[model samples]
Target: MIKGIKGVKDILPEETPRWRLIEETARRWAVLYGFHEIRVPIFEVTALFARSIGASTDIVEKEMYTFQDRDGTSITLRPEGTAGTVRAYIEHNRAADPLPQKYFYTGPMFRHERPQAGRLRQFHQFGVESFGVADPRADVEVIALLWRMLSDLKLPSMTLEINNLGYAADREAYRPQLVAFLKQREETLCGNCRRRIDANPLRVLDCKVPQCRAATEAAPRLADCLSEQARAHFGSVLGELEAIGIPYSLNHRLVRGLDYYCLTTFEVTSTSLGAQNAVGAGGRYDALVETLGGPVTPAVGFAVGVERMAMMLPLAASSSESASVYVAGFGDRGSAAGFSALEELRLAGIRAVTDFRSGSLKSHLRQADRLRSQFALIIGDDEVVKGSAILRDMETKVQQEVFLTSLSSQVSSLLRIS
Candidate 1:
């Protein structure tokens, strides 16, 4: 037998309700925040991510799933949602609109990584992005929407970790100071951190290595180097969050691993998943669109993992209350009529089912009992000749005969729809 590729997952039937609940909640909240749904393809030209996500970052260097097509063009399954959303906005010339465009998406995202806890090679993300909005208020609004989404899911005690990565000029000013600090601790930093020190020093702060953490503790902070204007923007974002009663905490080392993040980076974490505790995170990418050959556009967004949300919810018991009527037949002729009766029940808005092949009456009845059907209809030649049918309550074991003409309405009333 063939097996699914490692690191990917199949969402089984038993866990569907929780998935549906999260999707529904996100949709309702997105619409509430004036965002429309945008659907994009699973694959795109490989340059889209390499340019937008930054070639130096891990997502571009090691995590992307890139393949060369027959046309000799490279394509990659999207590892994140923001780049595609921005690409759609630019390709369609959405900037022509008078106001900012808000788009939300929920779909599978691919990444090449070890599968552990809520992390998967082909996991799903529900994200919302706002393009053309440069106001600090927009950043806070996006964070508030994410907070509301987690609360709606009843996720327990989520903590919001916020940081400011500083703007381009601010980074240019502080890069040397940060580099000097990392160089002094070169002997103690992790191998990855040591390599990234020259290319992207900001990522060194995000390292999870114990030795690197202790060594980089005294490294320069982005907040300390924030330009006067950048400082005002960060302050305004926090002020708006406080004005709207959203709670958050300052994490000086909260630099996200991605390269595009610049200012207002934040993450919502849960304690349920242990080491893989971060459920969602995002921040401002003001220069990403311009970097991808479009006019400069400021954007902010976040994505929540569906699998992690499912893990945090309570386990549900399997309930068999859905079946209200079951039709059973003893012969081929009766089987055809039984199916017709089943359709009639369904058209009348009743929960109904029937066996396609004829079987013994006792065996069919047992099947109905197993389904917990409230009502069972036994169809045979005798009932057809009498122009009537027997309706038995599987629970009470009571039997009654009624004219076929009135059966549809009777079932509707019994199910309380009428």
Candidate 2:
């Protein structure tokens, strides 16, 4: 039999409550922050990512799932959300609507990478983007939104790390200094870091290799080279974060992997998730809108890996209260009556279920108990004949006889008390 591909796992029914909780909580907090929901396609032209995410980045060079369509046009399954969101922002002429357009999106993102505990070939992300907001307040507001959402989820041991990548001009001036430094340690640096020395030198600071990390320890710092405007923007963001009581640590080497990001890059890491600790991250991308052929627009946004966040979520509390009633029928007449009652209870906003197979009263009760059903409604031939049924409170082992006319209301009242 054919099976699901490696690295992509199914979200079984048993595990969906936690996913629902995360999505609901994210939507709730996003709305509170004035972010409206936006849905973008899962795939886009390959150039969108290569141009926006940067050609030298690992996402475009190694991780992207790129394929040639029937027309020989290069298409790719999106590995991230920002590029698609900005594309939609420009395509739909959203820039004309208002000064800043806020959008939040949640969906599966595809990448061809080795699967790890929290990382997957097909994963999900919750992202928010705001366009045309050039002020540092936009940066602070977006980070605050992420922090608030995580707090709402009750995640523990989270750390927010912030850094300034400086503007393009600052980076341009610092590039030669950084490259010259890395070149001196050419043999000591990792192969990836060596390649990036000339192509994208700043990414060397983000390298994970032990030797590279050690070699770059004394490398030039981007923060030291930040232009006055970049420094003021970052300083203002930190000031606002302090004003709002959101504590953050300054990480001098926190340049994000993407090339579009510039100034005020930040990441939230969770100690609970080992190795792949970054739960969410984003920064200012003031040049991306123009890069995508739209008018120059400044935007700030962040994305949290749903898989990673789900890992850190506490095991959901298990309560039998959700499934309120189980309908148990003994015989043909009893089955019909139980089925009808199930429908009636559901129509009245009661959570109800039934066993399709005819079984003994004892067997039905056992099934109800196994399902953790709050109450079991037993319908037998006698009950059908009498136009009433037995309601058994599973927790108390107490039974009551109720007429069919009052069954829905009685169940509702009983549930409220329980």
Candidate 3:
């Protein structure tokens, strides 16, 4: 039997409501922040990610699903959303319109990695990008947006960790000092950290290997290397966050694994999700637009893992409940009446359904009970002749006759109760 490929799982019907809630909440809050929606293709030319996400980054080096098309052109399913979004911003001449372009996107992203509890080969993300805003307040606002969305989701026990990576020149000065420090402990570091010391020393700080983590623990901090300008920028970002009462902690070792990010970086972690604890993260990438062949643009954005967020959502609110009504009919005349009444309830915007089989009233009532319907509208030859039908309350099992024309109003009254 054919099976779904490993690392991919179906989002069945029962689970979609929570997914919808997350997506809708993101869209709602995104609009409230004046961010317009932007849709990018699921796949793009391979070079887009390689250049924008950094050639040596794990996303590019190890995780991207890259392949060659029949035309022999390299292509890749997007591992993240920002690169494609920035590409679209450039391709469409969006920079010409305004100083700041705010866009949000929600969609599937692909990465080839060992799937864990909340992480998947095919995962969905809700991301937002703000371009052309270089002010430190832009950083704070992006962080605020993320905080607000997560807060609105009612997640429990979350912590926001932020750090300063400084500017390119600042990093250049610090890079040598960090390398020299790591070189002394190279024998104790993991193989990956040993290789990264020369290629991208900052990545070594992000390594999870126990020995490498210990080796880099006492190493030079990025904050120590921040240029005056970078320090002021980061300070101003913090000042804004403080003024607004958004609590955050500084973690000097929290360098994000992206080459493009600079100045300020952040991640929101929840205690509920073990191991893969980071629910969302992003940073300022002031040079990425120019790196991707567009005019220099300053941007800050963050993406939340939808699956992880879904996992933490409260189950009580998401569980299915009894629908408003089930329209059940007994015979030919009764079924016709029930169908007409069903349409009336529907056109009135009541949640209504019917068993079209025109089965016996007892069987139809049982079907309605099975469906968890709040009310069952039973129609038979006698009630059809009288221009009315019996409305049976499924829970109370109380029966009442109602005129066909007034069924909607009657049900509306019943549904309004606490």
Candidate 4:
């Protein structure tokens, strides 16, 4: 037998309801916020991520799956949703519209990584991206939409960690100071930080190495580097969040791991999960559109891992109860009657199943018991001659003979009582 690939999972039938609930909740909440759904291709030109997500970032460097197609064009499976969404927005000239555009998408994202709890090589993300709006109110609106989405799922113990990375001018002014501080302790820092100092120095603050963490405790905060204009904008964003009663915390060291992010960066974390427990994160990317060779447009968005979301949502409340009706037949003639009755039950809006293979009544009931069927419709050669079925209630072990024409009404009434 052929084995499945490592670092990927098959979502079994039993786990589908949880996935369904998550998707349903996201669709409903997204619609509530006036965000329509847009889907981009799973694979796109390799240059898209390099220019938009940052070539030096881990997502583009070590994690992405890139390959050449038969036509010799380089194609890559998207590791994140925002960059592609932005690409579509620019390519289609969505800015031509007078109003800001909001879109939400749910799909699988690919990354080549070592598998761990709640992380997979091929995983799913539900994301929202808003374009053409630079107002601070837009920031609060997006964040509030995400918070309400989590609440709708009945997730537990989540906190919003909010921060402003400031604009390009603020970040540029602070880089020298941040670099000088790191340079003083270069020998004590890890090799990654050593290279990061020259490449993407802001990332030095986000390093997870214990030694690097010890070495960079005194690093200058981004808040102090904010330009006067950037500071005012950040203040306005906070005021809006406060006025709307959205809870948030100021994390000085929460420099988002992406270079494109600017002005605002935030994460929603859950306490139930440990260190890598962030369930959702996003920030503004004002320069990303211009950087991608499109007319400058401001955008902000967030992506939530479906796996992590599933871990937080309570399991289905009624999963333990039997909800289906099973139809069984004891002989070939009885089988014909059973199938016809199965259709009748289905037309009457009953969750009904039937045994195609002729079997003993006892064996069929055993199968129904295993399936946890709410009721079992038993048809035998004698019953077919009489044009009636014996309906057995699995829970109460009560049996009653009902005419063929009356079975649909009886089952419908029983299900309604349920």
TM-score of each: 0.94, 0.96, 0.93, 0.94
Candidate 1 lands at a TM-score of: 0.94
* Cα displacement (Å) at residue 101, model 3: 1.0
Residue pairs with colliding backbones in model 4 are none
Error of 4 at 197 (Å): 0.9
The lDDT, on a scale of 0 to 1, for candidate 4 is 0.86
Misplaced by over 4 Å in model 2 are 318-321
The candidate, 1 or 3, that scores higher on lDDT is: 3
For model 2, residues 299-377, the per-residue Cα lDDT tens digits are: 9999999988888876553222457899998887998888899999999999998778647888888888888898999
The digit string of per-residue lDDT tens for model 1 on 128-211 reads 998888899999989999999899878997999999888988999999999999999899998988998998998888889999
- What lDDT tens digits, residue by residue, belong to model 3 across residues 218-317? 9988788888999999999999999999999998878787789998999999999979999999999999999988998888999999999989986555
Give the Cα error of residue 96 in candidate 1, in Å. 0.2
Whole-model lDDT per candidate: 0.86, 0.91, 0.90, 0.86
Task: Give candidate 3 regions above 4 Å deviation.
Answer: 319-322, 405-418
lDDT score at residue 54, model 4, on the 0-100 scale: 83
Best lDDT among the predictions, by candidate number: 2
Off by over 4 Å in 1: 315-321, 331-333, 395-399
Residue 140 miss distance in model 3 (angstroms) = 0.1
Give me the displacement of residue 81 in model 1, in angstroms.
1.0
Of 2 and 4, the candidate ahead on TM-score is: 2
